[model samples]
Each structure stands twice: as structure tokens, then as C-alpha cells.
Target: MKDLEGKTVFITGGGGGIGGGIAQAFAERGTRIVLADIDQGFAQEEASRLPRSVEVMTLPLDVRSPESWKAARVEAEARFGAVDVLCNNAGISTGFRPLFDIPPEEFERVMAINVTGVYNGIQTFGPLMAARREGHIVNTSSMNGLTPFASFAAYSASKFAVLALSDALRDELAPQGVGVSTLFPGLTRSRMSQADLGKISAGDPARRAVIEANMMEPVWLGRAVVRAVEHDEPYIITHPDYREGLRARHERILAAFGDPAQPDYHTGMTATR
Candidate 1:
């Protein structure tokens, strides 16, 4: 992973703010890039920003579809050989609406694109990397995944699934020589984040400005991702300010571990049926 030069990196949602930042970070390391997105235009736009010397390709990829992933892999490998790194970063949010206010379809849509999309990517490319025994995977989770909040239930649930998927995949793939890392990003300037501005600021101009000012740059997260891949780190946390909140939540959960709620139950008992 330290030797990234000449490596081929494939990124889903390569058109978005964070994905573009990731592409840029890898491109800086002389890694060839495949910027795949459902909106091919956005992928191309990001590719155009890279230096001409960098080998970058843009493709239309709907991460929710396994067929789309297969086609993308075929085309990408045809152009630049097998992917050395895979960044499953494509996702959608359910906005900041309350859980009850959100429609069933909206919740399903978020889970489909945010959670299933990552799974599809993993299924498509993970085996190949495992066979090669030399590759890394970076799955984009969210700060909300670590610390959930009201009005963001569906989105938080989807991101939380990403963390679970990444963690399990890491354990399953590490022994096979493939590294997996989960990125828990906080508010970074993106189309999705901008769209939530009103709700986040509660229509207050000063609050809106302050929130905007505090938004992290997408490239910084990308840089952190790059470091994670290089070091084979399991978790990439870009926003440390939320650490206390996450710690508190964990402590609360841990405190609930009392007796198994049954007078005769023992901790080491194994199920026989």
C-alpha cells in the first residue's frame, strides 16, 4: 500500500465532493484513477481538474447494481489493468427529516444507495483483490454512523451498517492479504451537506454561516483516507471533535451489561439447540 505509484485506484461516486477529493489525493501519489459515478458528467468534471499527466478515466456507475459494477470493472481493467485499490464511497442521505415524517420509500432509498451500494462494490471487486493478495479497500461511513442523532435515523442506520460491513470485511479479508478501512466523516462541504444547511442552521443566518465555516474540506478527508490506506489502518476518523459524544454513547451501552436478565443464565453458556 505504501507503494501507490502506478497503482490503479477505482472510486465510486467519484464525482461528489468527497470522492473527488479522494481521487485528487490518490492522483497526487501518481496512482491512476477510475472515477465512476452515476452522473458521468460529475465524474468527468472531477477528472478534468487533475493534471494531464495523471491517467484518469471517468465512467457512469450505479453502485446499487451489480451489473453496473461488473461492466465498470471490465471497462476499467481494459483501460488500466486490475484495480489496485477500491474506494466504495457512493452514498445518499435521507436529509434531516424526522423518522416518522420520512416516507417508507425514502428510507428504503437511503438504505439501498448508502448501504447496499457499498455491499455491491465489495462483492464485485473484493474477491479479485483477495485472489491477487495485494490490495486495499476503503469504505466511507459517517460520523453519524458512530454517533446517531434524532431526525437522522435512516441515514444514521445506513452509515452504521457501512461500519459493520467494513469491520467484518476487514477481519475476513486481512488474512487473505487485503486491507479494509472505514472512513467516518463528519460535515464536509458537498452538495448533500449544502442541501441540509437550512435544517442544520434552523433558518438562522448566523448559525448557517458558522456551520459553513466549520465544514471540513473534502480534500482533507481524502488525505486522511490516503494515509489510512498506506498504513493499513482500520478506521479513518476525520472529525475528532465528536469523539467525546461517541465515547459517552459507548459508555452508556457498556453500562447495560449486567447479568443476562435471567437468574439461571451464565455468561459462558453455549446454545445447544
Candidate 2:
């Protein structure tokens, strides 16, 4: 953890903005990077953007397929040794649509990439790291995961699942000397976000302008991820503007916690029964 130099990092969605940003950050720390994405061309593009001195491998990875994961891992291990850090960053958004309005197939695709993809990455790489008794995993969630909103129900649900998975994985890996961190990025500049904007706010130049203005540079978030990895931090909140909303959500959940509605409900000391 202290010295990232010479470590190997396998990152899903490495072709995208956030993944590229993460690759750059880790490269700066002298870590070898494997950029895995469904689009090999985009992965190559991101790889080309990295420092020439950094060791980088680009591979096509369909995170939804275990076969793809297996092939990627084979290539990665053939190039570099065992992966020291796994970044489950590949994901897709379903645009801003109400829950009932979203197509079931589209909703399923969102879950496949955003939620199940992370799970696949964990299942594929977790044991290797655990056996070694050292490694780290970074799963990218969104600010929406912490504070859900109306139109983004499906995306938010997938992100929420990522957060839960990361938390549980962290607990499970703690004893094995592995670390897990969940990244909550807010309005970062990425292809997926830009496309979502087109879908949800297509002709509204003004709305797009404001959102663009607020979009954080991907590298900045990447730097935060690197710091989190270095410190083995559990949660990485790059944008603090969402804290107030998160606070309100937490408050509501806390308010709902009350004594059991049964007179003879004596469950446990920890439970309020």
C-alpha cells in the first residue's frame, strides 16, 4: 500500500474518462496498468494517453461475461504478475427516466454493467488477492448511490448495489489483508454522462452548459482514488457538494429507526425490539 511502484493494477472501463484518469494516477505512482474495456480501441486510446515510461496493457473485457474476465486475467497475468489492485470501474447509465418508463431490457443492461460487472470483477480477482493476503479493490459508485433521486432510479439502484457490495467485500477481505474502497463521483466528464445528457436534456444548451461547468475533471477524481488506495480508505467522496443531500437522506433513515411494534418482541440487545 505504501509503495505502489511496480505494483500491477487491472482496471475495468479503462478506456473511459474515469478509468483513464485512474490509470494515469496509478501510472504516475509507477504502477503497471492493465486497461480493460469492451471497446479495445478506446482502451488503446487511453493507453496512448499515458506516459510513455509507464507500463500499460490494453485488453478487451466484457465485464458481464466471466469468459471475458478469464481471458483478460490470463492476458494480464501473462504480461504482468498477479494483479495488486483491481478497479471495478466499468459501468453504464440508463439516462434520466422514471422507473416505470425505463425499458426492462435497458434496466437489466444497467444492472449488468454497473452492479453485476463489479461483482464479476470481485469474484475473478478477489481470491487471488486474498490468497496473497494483500491487495486492494476500488469500485466506482456515484453520488446518486448515497442520495437517490427521481428520474435516475435505475442508475441509482445499481450504484447503491455497488456501495453495498464494496462495504461487504471490505469486511470479508479485512481478515485477509485486502482492502476495498467505494468511489462516489459527482458529475465527472465522461462519455457515459455526456450521452446521458443528450438523452435527458438534448436540445437544452443552457442546462448542458451548467452541468458541463460543474463537471469535475476525471484526473482529479483519479488522484483521489490513488490517495484512497494509498491510505486503504473505505469511501472516496470526490465531490463534497452532495454531502448535504446525503445528510438529509441519512436523517430520514435514522428517523425511521424505532422500537419494534410488538410488546413481547425481545430480539437482541442490539435490536430495538
lDDT (CA) for every model shown? 0.92, 0.93
Which candidate gets the maximum lDDT versus the true structure?
Answer: 2
> How big is the positional error of residue 134 in model 1, measured in Å on the Cα after superposition?
1.3
Each prediction's TM-score versus the true structure? 0.95, 0.97
The superposed Cα distance between candidate 1 and the true structure at residue 53, in angstroms, equals: 1.6
Tens digits of per-residue lDDT, candidate 2, 129-185, equal: 999999999999999999989999999999999998999889999999999999999
For every candidate, C-alpha RMSD to the true structure in Å: 2.6, 1.8
Local error of candidate 1 at 44, Å?
0.9
lDDT of 2: 0.93
Candidate 1: the clashing residue pairs are none
Predicted structure 1: clash tally? 0
Clashing residue pairs in candidate 2 are none
